[model samples]
Target: MNSEQLIKSLLKQEEGDQLEFKLVVQKDSIGKIICAFLNHEGGQVLIGVSDDKKIVGISDAEKWEKELTDYLNSAIIPEAPVMVSLEQVGNKQVILVKVWAGSKQPYIFDGNIYFRRRQSTVKATSQEISNLIHNRQKNEFHWERQPALGVELEDLDLQEIQKTVDRSINESKLDENNRNPIDFLTHFGLFQNGHFTNAAVVLFAKNPALFIPQARVRVAFLEKGKTAGEFVDDKLLDGNLFKNILSAQDFFEKHLHTTRKFSEKEWERQDDYVVPMSALREGVMNALVHRDYSLPSASMSVIIYSDKIEVFNSGKSPLKAAELKKSHLSLPVNPDIAHMAFLRGYIEKIGRGTIKIMDACKTAGLKPPKWTTTETSVKLSFPLNIKLGGATDGGLVGAGDDNINIRIDGAIDGAIDGATTRTIRQLTILLAAIIKDEGKRIPDYKNITDLGSVRTLERYIEQLKDIGFIEFKGSAAQTGGYFITDKLKKIIK
Candidate 1:
């Protein structure tokens, strides 16, 4: 992929030593430069360029070429070394060294991991290096692959595993007769070489730490967006994914309440589809679907606040989040986890979770959640239903079950663009009024609608028409209007 353009493109962003250019005249210094970039924000070290980027091309690029190759071979295995390439730029052949912000934090070289300080490579202070290395072993902490030493597979809770599989299959709508626990595990790619992968065991193993430590999910219900706030609630989820997922669901349901009905309107219990429920549910689904099972200190997290819920899991997304939102890509960091979620009906087929999320929010009259995946974590924000003890609409307020519709409406009010909000709201009202023969057509808005004047209703109809959310027809009927393209229909179709 456009390696030259990639380097030039990154220059558009604010840069520091995170992306520094180095003139590697001495082949011996290549290893240290590799360590510096790997241990930091991951920069490009252009070999032939001067500090000012002048094209003082290397006389013999092959010296650094051999050194670069040897450096990778000598670096720690698994994570290996930064990716390096030689390219010609403006008559000068520059060796482009691309290092990822290494997932394995502090990279040790020559018995010492060197950190870059304002373009200077310095050995890490003892305390700093200890902390850095301590945090580096996230993805390397594969518990299932290691033996529990004396522990056997019998150490697992078979009965619980059976229950989990049954529940997952039921939730997923799979044929019960065809899916056994082992079979389901195999289908999810959790089973490998006669044994379950670490991820599989995290989701199903009785005591995952028996062989693999750090296989638990972390859930925190916070206030004020910080951990020190009133510990709204906290939990360390264990057992298999099935049990853990369902348990997480139950935990929030207990703390987060919704109204039995939104309005005194008889259609209240009729599934107006409040977004918080969907948000809470999807947040867990995303965590389970994307979390990196190999990461130790980096674990799955679900943070619930008074105003919003933020869900995070380990691993940088392979797809830019903008692409994920636009395309139907399922680049799962943990395919086994994603497959398990798919089978359990936690994730939709065709990798259409984002689409469903958008659809659900539109249907619920709530805003779709925003997606942002970074190098360290994947985050989703579900807007809070109630703010400051009152809905954003300024009607009702309170926590738990008393305020559901308010939150639902608030999300829509806050998230969508102005044009979209107006168009969708009009469609919702019009569709709600339409049933059997009780409603008017798209162009008949002025008469049948209850939101005020004929002229105002006509303006709304016209706006909807121009926006492609509505179309009109017929026999010179001035007041005729209809929801030709409601957001929900548009989303699904």
Candidate 2:
């Protein structure tokens, strides 16, 4: 609507949530009114209109606008933008002061908090002020600040702390002064009064789940849907939050379907998830940072089915589905944990998780994840992009793994990103061993790869399977061994 039309429409209405009227521009009083509007739904304070709806226009519209804008900038803490325009109504000029509801909130004007209540602008009560402070401190207070019982400084991993410090320093998220583990922890408030807070333990503890066992993640691969399915793989991931994130990624990678992006040259090929890795990573990180840790009986879980993959976490998100789907507000259940995670780079930015996930899915040419929530739990379902053997509506195609078609074009490429010298060596050895001695146990593969750690061997196997280079023969009831897939051979030639 035009300025005059808008003014006329607002004139006929009573002042309420988004409407306010003022006779003259009182700098201090107007600032408080603006603060109230910002704290609530955005509204306009119409100058030249009185409290009783009298249309006594301001003599100099420009003068009132300049004065109010100056006062707002100088008097408001965390200066917020305001719009002031002179509009003509009949023969007189009216000043329209527009304020937007702030996302970076708890706005203060002239040392006082103000809020609007149904046409009335008033000073914020003590309780209201407290609530605002608490909300802002979501990451400042909570489990992250509380000391973990029976946990000591030595129990934490100094290497992880050092890595976090180095990266955070390079990113300028943290200063270079605190380079040591203890100093870094102290500076970030991870160490409170000579005690390690629960956040410190969760981030750096050798075994974080020792204190909070339910903090671990459980991942499963199922042949059917949510209700019932033949379990292909089920494992509990335990360790620090960082470890759990890595383990969860490994678990998902092994189960999620991938499609081949064949290159013009036979050897030049790329493999990727149809749903995108970014979306899955975001979902897992959300489950870790925002899950309710108070419920000891509940644990975070990821379940894969033929049609979709569901990531479940204990406790319902305080944020409504509408809020997540719209505003992208950052209201973390464990703010302290989130704060550390942010500095450590577990999360890219605050309040952008769901939006990132949606965008990632869209970019990958897939539908966005389906969100489901209960009072006790929250679940995110990402539908598998590929229709497994022409199965569309969550129904299985047939017996045997061949029913699910994984179109792999070539053998595993050791030259792919993140392939170090040792990794390449391991891969070359494993591939040769699998080709030379088919259907051998992991011990035999380990001997050929010369990778002593079982965990490391398992990780490489998972990566190989994820890229469609190899498959395990035999079942849970019988001995199984890794073997190169036929698809890999088809492209290798």
Candidate 3:
């Protein structure tokens, strides 16, 4: 915010949350720095401040001001202008322009989102892209109406919209009055100027391909048919939620091997390795809901190779990929989409899609699906382990809700990934520590016991002792079992 600090930041030669500096020999490089701040972490770009931090003031400040203003407004998408200020440090002048991160992110200059990392202005890595999205999400960015051009509301499939409304009225409390799709969008805060947002278009447009040319959900048979075995089938998926899911399920079942279950009657058949309908429903629903429509890319894709099924979409995540790996992860890209899926019975409100997928695969005896995400995409892989065979006979149970074993099992699975979102749950041991001093065993939160919270508290106490995160000074009892450790303070920090 200040030239003195900006000069210091430039000298440090370190890149992080904010701050980048450049010695621009010409105006083109100025564009790069401006784009860098807009695309990644918001920062102040200081020119005339040498890369090594020596300030050399511009001889013509007015010329540089005109140069910067022209580039930021005319050359950026979701067009955001940079705020430029000039300062004199010792014998030199510095041109400082503040580029705030965009609300609709992935800010492009000449067609790509340029970002700052340490000493360079380059393409942002997937993680950096994802973080930009996380920050922008808090400032009211919606998936639709971004990069808006080439389409209108009526261009969308009205039938699809009507059916969605019908489903909402039939199953949810959306309205006795607001039963129209247009009204539904208004009710959902997705309408501007009486037209649908890009989210609406991508999720339910009759032919989203007309506007978003790359918009699709492809199902490929990779590792087969003699190529890299990759299928780039440029086909479109359309219709109501049920039909769309059914079609996607059909595509998945095509790749599966089914078996005959001989019962008392004639017979029943099942896929040898079907991706659980529940999981796929949740996954695909998430694909539809959480996708980053701001980017000019595909809406969603499901690629089934020989070893696994990879489901991908433009998912703007709330956490870094490393943080996601370290904690139990759940960040809905679109809560309204989630709510819609929940009422329609495709997904539950509990937000444990990973748990549901794992359970369905387990009861059917398949290895749990693996998850990997970058800023632009989230990919979930369900292994083909034919030896595990297709899960048959276990009816779909609530993996995300109405289940405790599911949440506990999720904690364990996530433990394999290093305990992502459940960090606070682990910190609940502090809840126990605070009570242990009062000489009372604070029993449990009987109301929300479905979290297996009581069991987790006891296990956390045991774990704290085991790893030295806590200690027991006296003999163990129902009460007065311990005091926290040095590690506890580290965790507190």
Candidate 4:
């Protein structure tokens, strides 16, 4: 409901198990009420309201909002989900602190368990604490442990299973005795009671989509200003988890451009992709390892735009968005899947993937990647531009006598006046290569430019040729190649 409607409805209710009213911001009293609400059914605490239910607004709503939010974030134990906002009730403003029923219950406050007893908040009795703990444990179910109804060992890829065993053994993540595929699966809890679990199928099945269609990753490459339906290229990848990861990386390599920077201090060259490849790998791996496969229609996706790359997964993160930036506990939604990935060295057991992504970006002089969460999914975005180093004047510069320093800015159009740094570099490299060798073939251009595909190289060559910078100098039957035109040679010193 809208804030106005919600506040109007809440105003008519008396303070009880699901609602509380306070005349001012009493930090201790509000903490107890929020803790009790988390332990029981979720509730709301409204500040600036009298004990008689009058809307006596606070003196400064903005200041109270931040003060209460900071208090809740710090005072609460285990970091429960609490939302604090300012809402208007009639002509006055009130602070509303909304708390959700904690999935990990027994939320503690000041070394005690608080309980909501009808209309009052008090310390929980011993029996109530025991019941909360017992209920939490009883309701915890791991979906990955469930049996795949018709899946068999033969349906899994034996070679991939063997590879995992070898890699895990080499990495000391698995014992030598578990080298066999069946033993490896059993050790990792993928095989129970002589039946294959869903994780086994997800990790090693030849065609996981046949059994669980949601076990797929969709990738798309879109040019700047393009809609979702208008894609430069896209693919739906389905197979074992390892295969999908590798395939997605290959797709990224195909579409993403690499930038080369020459370091004058080291007298060496360094090459980096537009977006850090390691960060993208971590993003994809995290999406797969933590995905909620129980939602049959939900799947992961990687959308590549000209300016940013977005990696989206099916489930909301266990921690809040703010918590992800700081140190938090590792709470994997699919433990079995995460465990297998860990053993294979694809991911670590500790919660450091987000940190790794941010670090990679910072080291590469790019803006830090952003993580956004919603009710049903989480998305990680890597902006392609916004560099922190190199040219600060928003124009290209020369690093050395023979090296040109190209830095990507916010512009993405491919025109001469507004071309992306990568595009300009490609065109310049192609022309320089032609100048060095008078008759350069397409293969030679591909080798020198290191563009992902022959089609991309040809596009660059065509752009140069159309601008009267180069020309073809041979017939169809004879040996032919592109040669620099006099128009281009006149500019060369």
Candidate 5:
């Protein structure tokens, strides 16, 4: 809908959590409302509207829009994402200020955090502010922020901490003035309230495995069709997160096959590993940075198979399996750890690690990486140049296993070979949505597939039903929806 129609529709509604009406543009009141909206789910502020749902418009909306935009940019901490526009109602103009939920929370206005309480904007309480801070850190009760019991300055490796500070300064990620280990720890929120946090221990502890056993990584090399326990060689890497990362790289270099070939065209020799080291390094860093440290009994693992390698960690990604293939938000399970990893030049803050892994594999003429997540763990698999059912002539293998490839190939050839590319893409999207959740109704599929008409979506759905990929269950009046059939589930498995 256009802005005029949307404003007219909102005019009939009362003030609520996401809707606020003001007769004038007061910087103080408007700032509070904007801050509250950012702290909560996003909202819209309609200036020149009264409390009783009157549409008495403003005199000059252009001036108000620019002024309010400037005020919010300077007043709100961290510079909230807000849009100010002038919209014409029936006979007058109104200033519409739209705010989205801030990824970085606890938006402060005039030194106080504001939150929306139903239809009112008020200053946040101490407990509410604490919750916002924790939520901004991406965990309700962040394990990394907790005090490390029995850990002191003596327990941490002072030299390693100093080296990190130096490296960060050289990388222009930190100010050179704060060169002390204590200062570095305090600057990164690793030291708080006169006590060292668990993050500090994980990053600088002399023997982190002694205190946090799960901080270690287990690397193993298994033959074809072998279990994890029966490994040809394995090692339990210890020390800090950075140390373990480097040690894992060393293990990969020693075990993974490498080839050196002379290129006459270039007058030089080229060397490469079976899989790109960049992809493996990224996978390992992701496993460490995103691991669930609260699960003290669980540890990360790097398992090498004859045809693939798997990096497994005890934490579920906030993103869905299909979402990883596209652009998505970066919702790190451990924000503190992720931030430190970024500063050290080990990872990026944006959610591009998976994309980088896939791109690197594709550039190397290998199959794209796959991400699989369970209720409590996430595993990333990288394929190698080994044929499963055919002769191995040093060629990249296909994406999935033999059974899945056969089933999917047969289904596609029999059902969708004659369909248009757009229809096939829509079918893939529909199947992904249903696999993610079977209770999705027709409307949900339409929204996901971006189909403007239900009739068009039903045609695609009918095709799937005819192919035995999905089946309808229950009645339309009751809890009825399209669900994946056993044939599709077997192929997925």
Candidate 6:
């Protein structure tokens, strides 16, 4: 807003979190107010404005502005960058000093650390001070170790604990001792004095999203980058970390393509993912276990684009991407969560997740995953091998050991009367794509179609197969695939 509009807006509002009115620049107290604003969400101090929201102009704003700048340079511990400008309010001149929210927390003035709470500048409590220090130094931050309020032992999923124990025992990492869930939690330090830590809440809570609103993984299948465009499959994966991980994996598996090749000796079909599932899982688990939960507004996310998938978590890595690409130490943001994930066989070699993902991508003959970061978030993007209408030696189907070309035929017109010719053509194109490769199940077909229910699509497939236009393959128990018949090819011709 312009100076006049800004003044009018500021005058209309009361002095609160983002704004404070001062009649004059009090040299001693002004620094404290600025420090408080810097420590909290940065705010504006309007000089020449009265307590009652009157626009009483300052006599010498230029003089006071000079003094404020000089004081700021010399008074604060770390210099706070601010914008100080004199704006004309009617006949009066009001100085607007705007201080932005600083990345450096606990900005100190003189000997005290100040914080802005509502309209007052208060000294930070010991715990608040500790939190500030921890926020600045990520390695020292233990947000997961902090107790999750309103959480109880019963809130945890007993099945999760059992699964962890079972995995540990099978791996011989733990003895098959029948320790109770509570005792096991205590042993891992997730159960503190009469309370569950945030780590415990994340790993085992029936719905951790209830305790931590931003704990869930947000997955979006976007047509365009970042925007939810045509063909979007946006969903928030909630519940405990394990459940979210599984849900995210399911989402990826549905959207991603697979390459199929037959083994000569065994006559067995081997399916290779466009992006390695292991690498994707590692990325997801790492995001879940190491995200900065202290950032109450931020949540982890898996965004899938047509050509790529991005997995993001709040909080930048302590180690740089280049450093991680080489040998580097792992400094997990949530150590307690990471520890539990490690024990559960979710994460391996604490610091090797990045290297492994890169190696996996290379092994699959795909481009290396791109790692990018901002001050508040880390993102890993894995590019997809196939684009729209892009064809490889085999398409998105893995049936038995043969490649087949099946032409769309009018022979199914009398047999299947429900669907339109356009719909049938679309279905034919989809099945033909599969036939070019091996074969695909209903889920893969649903992904290709991306518009109908599984049961509905299954009926159509059955009708086509029954009419002798398509043939079925693979085990009946499994979601087997369909191939166009040679007899139908003659009818179309």
Report the C-alpha displacement of residue 38, candidate 4, in angstroms.
24
Q: What does candidate 1's lDDT look like per residue over 1-493, in tens digits?
A: 1335444554453435655666655544666766776676555566675656556766667666656655564463323324455666556667766554555567777777777777677787887677677765454344433323443356556676566578654543334653576665554445545766666566667766655555677787664445346666787876566777777877776656443333333433333323446656776777776666656667777777655667778778776777655423333566445544554456643334665566666555555678798987788777643331222221123343243333333433333445343344443344333311233653343333444577666665565455454444444455543534565244323
lDDT of each: 0.55, 0.69, 0.54, 0.72, 0.73, 0.69
lDDT (Cα, tens digit) per residue for candidate 2, span 317-417: 87666666532334456655676677667665445578777777765556667888889889998875443322323111223332122222223443356
- Candidate 1 regions exceeding 4 Å error are 1-151, 159-194, 209-213, 224-228, 260-268, 271-276, 388-395, 400-493
Q: Superpose all Cα atoms of candidate 3 onto the true structure and report the RMSD in Å to 1 decimal.
A: 19.9
| Cα lDDT tens digits for candidate 3, 1-493 | 2345535545565645456566663556666667886666556666775655667668777677666656555566654435565756666777766654544567777767778776578877878778777866754555544433555666766666676678656642345577766777766545656556666666566666666665556665553422454453434565434456777887766555442221223333222334566766667766666666566654677766544677887765666544432212243556445545554556532334555566667655456677787766777777643211122211111112213323322323333334422332323324332322422332532111222356665665555456555566654564454555665444433
Error of 3 at 416 (Å): 36
lDDT of 4 by residue, 1-493 (tens): 3345556667788888888888999989999999998888778887887777778999888988877767775676644556677877678898888765665578898888999988899999999999999966753446677788788877999999888788766644455787888887876668878888888889999999988899988999765434435687778998889999999999888766556643435544466676789989998998998888987888899988755789999887887777776433444677667656765778642455776787777766666788899889999999755211222211122112133222221111123554444565556555655665567688776765455489887888888777677899886456888987776555443
Query: Which of the two candidates, 2 or 6, achieves a greater TM-score against the reference?
Result: 2
TM per candidate comes to 0.47, 0.55, 0.45, 0.54, 0.55, 0.52
Steric clashes per prediction: 22, 3, 18, 0, 0, 1
Cα displacement (angstroms), candidate 3, residue 25, comes to 69
Against the true structure, candidate 4 has what lDDT? Answer: 0.72
TM-score of 2: 0.55
Query: What lDDT is reached at residue 83 by model 2?
Result: 56
Candidate 6 backbone overlaps, count: 1
